[model samples]
Target: MAVTTETAETGLVVRYSFLWPREHDRGEREGRKDRPVCLVVPVNVAPGAVVVFPITTQDPLPGRIAVAVPETERRRLKLPGDRPCWIMLDEANGDVMPGSFHLVPFETHPLRYAYGRFSPAFMRVVLRTMAEAIRARQLRMVQRER
Candidate 1:
């Protein structure tokens, strides 16, 4: 099924071309690859915008903030449980739902599809962690074109 604005809720994991802050600063308009990203904000009706954090298997660099994905959660999302992954909370991408070019779809599907969604309990934890960063003014958001 296509990922409509209603389906693109907070905690939804979808494949997106997430342009990093550094990349945006360098004038690069596109991300290098399509990676799993967790939607961190609700899709607002006025602009149809949402915030997303990239999920990576690589370890966070020194002084960077990240949240480890639990093994149980990985299994639930059909991800490799043996490998470690984290949600990058120090930075995020802002994009519009329903019309974003960088939002990739599943191979078997023509429209945008979610890999899965994080449980509400886990999502709360993520939001709290992100809030800390936001309050500290440590989070950088890169707004992308729709």
Candidate 2:
């Protein structure tokens, strides 16, 4: 897939090879297949580098950072109907290649790929949630320092 101006935007969703945690000390690992993800950064910053958040269909587990995809918004985005999907905030800072971002590209790259994007309103909510998470983390760090 080729990264273009049209496809690069905040809240854009794409299919890519996302890194997942291992059970033991095996280190982080990404599956051979591509998975859905959300673009958390604007496209104007860099050519190929952009921050992303992983999207999953698994139920939200305790202690895991995640945001549920509202059914209305899910329908608007036309996400898969197989099961409920959620954005994994804990897995947000992934990067992609310059030519890996796309809005339904012809060929998907092994390390990067994309399908579609989310609406502006949805993106705003995502950004707000992320900001709140960061603030909470900062507060914790400050408390620990005291």
- Candidate 2, residue 68: Cα displacement in angstroms equals 1.3
* Candidate 1 lDDT trough over 10 residues, lowest sum: 40-49
lDDT of 2: 0.59
TM-score of each: 0.91, 0.69
Candidate 1's residue-wise lDDT over 1-146, tens digit each? 46686787888898888899999999999999888899866534555678889999999999888899988888788753368899999999988886878888778776646788999999998999998988889899998875
Clashing pairs in 1: none
lDDT of 2 by residue, 76-124 (tens): 7666666778987655444544554222333535533455677787777
Model 1 segments beyond 4 Å from truth? 42-47, 80-82
Strongest candidate by TM-score: 1
